[model samples]
Target: MQVQVKLFAFFREGRFIKEDKELPTDTTAGQVIDDLNIDREEVGVLMLNSRHCKFDTVLQEGDIYAIFPVIGGG
Candidate 1:
């Protein structure tokens, strides 16, 4: 399946802002994060097609999956 992955904040430091990924069937959101070497604890929000989702969320073809880093503020 092909899914569009978007990274926000520090998550895009050494990675792209957005890209289309070719993944196997049944691939979860966490799996993609692992592949990108992103720590689960650093994840602030997970979105699938603009809706909040979880790490175990199953991704589908043409899905727009976004990952945001935990925001830190004063």
Candidate 2:
């Protein structure tokens, strides 16, 4: 199975390019990030097709996902 992953802000700054990634069956968003050497702690929100998702959220083939960093208060 394959899924599209979009990394933003801090992630992109970390050298991650937004691209379609091939994920194995039963793989979760966290797993994909882990495989890519990304730390889940750095990501504030996770979305699957624009819906809030968790790290444990299992990925489906052809699914689109976006990850964003958390902004702190002034």
* TM-scores for every predicted model: 0.94, 0.85
lDDT of each: 0.95, 0.83
- What does candidate 1's lDDT look like per residue over 1-74, in tens digits? 99999999989999999999999999999999999999999999999999999999999989999999887679
Error of model 1, residue 69, in angstroms: 0.7
Model 1 worst lDDT window (10 residues): 65-74
Model 1 / residue 30 / CA error / Å: 0.5
RMSD to truth, every model: 1.7, 2.0
lDDT of 2 by residue, 1-74 (tens): 87889987778875666788776799988887787677878879899988999999998988998888786667
Model 1: how far residue 4 lies from native, Å = 0.3
List runs of model 1 lying over 4 Å from the truth.
72-74
Shift of residue 65 alpha carbon in model 2, Å? 0.8
Off by over 4 Å in 2: 72-74
